[model samples]
Target chain A: MPCPYLEYRDTSADQSFDEARAFCTVVEEFVQPMRADICNDRYALDHESHCEIYRAHAEGEE
Target chain B: MSYEAFLDGDPVIVTAALTGGVHGKEANPNVPETPEEIGRAAGEVEAAGASVVHLHARRPNGERSFDTERFQEIDDAVRRHTDDVVIQHSTGGTGAPDADRHRPLRTDPPPEMASLDMGPLNRYDHLTSENTRGLVDSLHAEMVDRGIKPELEVFNDGHRNEVHGLLARRDLADPVYATLIFGPGTLTRPRPEHFLTAIADLPDGATFNTLGFGRHQLPFATMGILFGGHVRVGLEDNVYYERGELAESNAQLVERVVRVAEELGRPVATTDEAREILGL
Candidate 1:
């Protein structure tokens, strides 16, 4: 199934995950190096885990 | 374990609400009070297809207590039976001091997860459910800092929004989970439209389970399966299996949920599966 959040943001109605992953790529713009730097210690990519930070903000707008 | 996986028709995670903040033998003689009894009940439910155990500690006299020592003992006993069953200690028991409320979060050896209410509410006689934003914020930070997953208890739409706020502030871990509770005087009624609407707009990666106070327990479990969500069931939610019928043990309630889910073709999540599913 399509990623629900991606469908929500793009209004694609596909309910797919690829759309969500693709959306995450756009999000990596700001969160990429910053989140990687943040997640380095004691947390295997903590900031980027699930890309939740970007998703929460993006989905909240919808 | 992620919502993408779960929403892809994954097995349903069954959480056994072994002992809640309220109720005792008077409600059901089989309700486990002491650590030994709780340990036995935990084993039975795990064997009966339960992957997680949500627990509350009681004083030697059977009254609820948030003492770290009591929770530690109960956690130890439950672990002795099987490490597979995820132990989710609760921090939201009623009538406890602020110190006691924070005990589980600050305890030496924390649990896999802990019950954290979104905010406060008004309930039965002389009871006021209060979870201030300040405390809620602090608790969220502690859970993230200690590696303890927060099993957010959602009492209404406000609670739902509160979770989003926490996420925006990055106070919670990824794949966050919520337990939407429906009971007498709850903000939302126990109806399909109400439940569906409440979680329909959930943010991506946010998953929630469902439960009811008494008569609504079985219905809540049934609805959860039908809606592609997880389920919570046990004596803590209801002592009776049906009208005028008292359940013999928590295993009885859990067995009923398993049988129903099977008849509907939804496989049960194993102990390890639950840990992974919940991001433990």
Candidate 2:
């Protein structure tokens, strides 16, 4: 998917960090600073992790 | 954290509503009213842990005032004591029939931030506080025009919707700052579920602080920090610091919030950080 912050048209789907870097290299030439500032902090991330675990448990039961 | 960056992280901003308009000298002898007393009380609270001081002005006779002179006096006095603490003035005057509640904003030099009630709410089981939509729009416009950030006061789910609508209409800015007021016999009951549900409905880029009425202050305040929000505490919301014991000063309440934040492992936001977070 296209990056929400960037206005690129030939963007591909979301992928792992290495895959994303390779795709960016193929599509264009840019080296943007990777800042995790936009990412949620440890608390919110931990909450999300718990939610994923609960979802997996529910899926397994089904 | 960068100012804007920290808000996205939901840093807790504790505001001490030092002297609310509800109680007079008869209710709590230590409640500050005069300029000197109010300023001194605010200074102590800021020192304790509060980044912001919510102010309500009164004459020597202990009557609330929306008049500019009274507000200026209190503002000047607070400035005299401390320049780092944020000063927020209340728009809710005495629960009077004909009193102009918005008179403080009408003052020549308005407050840096003003309280804007989103909707009407019942107070304590006797008084009906009026907060019409037209009043909200007008007040919001004035505050935006005057470069004053409004502390949106939400008492229920409907009030939350109103705030959302205001933002959708571009009447308010991003990172919408609000105060979720919880009290008995009001629109919102003071409970964990009430807080959780209210917060769940908050829009993206929005931040809120919580305050409970009467004795429920500490519980809801504690929850506010744990739930990734801010806290507001003072005699204005509750006169008693503990069960059956009247609070001696606003500083005592501020000190309590400080302790609670420390216990919860949440760092208190400074005035400058709060201004940047709230876009004040």
Best by TM-score: 1
Span of 10 residues, lowest total lDDT, candidate 2 chain B:
B1-10
lDDT of 2 by residue, B1-280 (tens): 1224333445578898877765555466677778998899888888887889898876554545567788888888998888688878888632432236666776556677899888877643223566877777777787788777899899877899988877876567667888988876655877788888898788876788888888889998888877788889988878898998999888898888888887667778888888887887
Fraction of the true interface contacts (Cα pairs closer than 8 Å across chains) found in each model: 0.00, 0.00
* Candidate 2, Cα interface RMSD: 26.0
Q: In CAPRI terms, where does candidate 2 land? A: incorrect
Candidate 1 positional error at A41, Å: 46
Q: What is the TM-score of each candidate against the true structure?
A: 0.77, 0.76
lDDT of each: 0.72, 0.70
Measured with C-alpha atoms, the lDDT of residue B88 in candidate 2 is: 87
Over 4 Å off, model 2: A1-62, B1-10, B94-99, B107-109, B123-127
| Model 1 steric clash pairs | A1-A16, A2-A15, A2-A16, A2-A17, A3-A16, A3-A17
Quality of model 1 by C-alpha lDDT: 0.72
Worst ten in a row by lDDT for model 1 chain B: B1-10
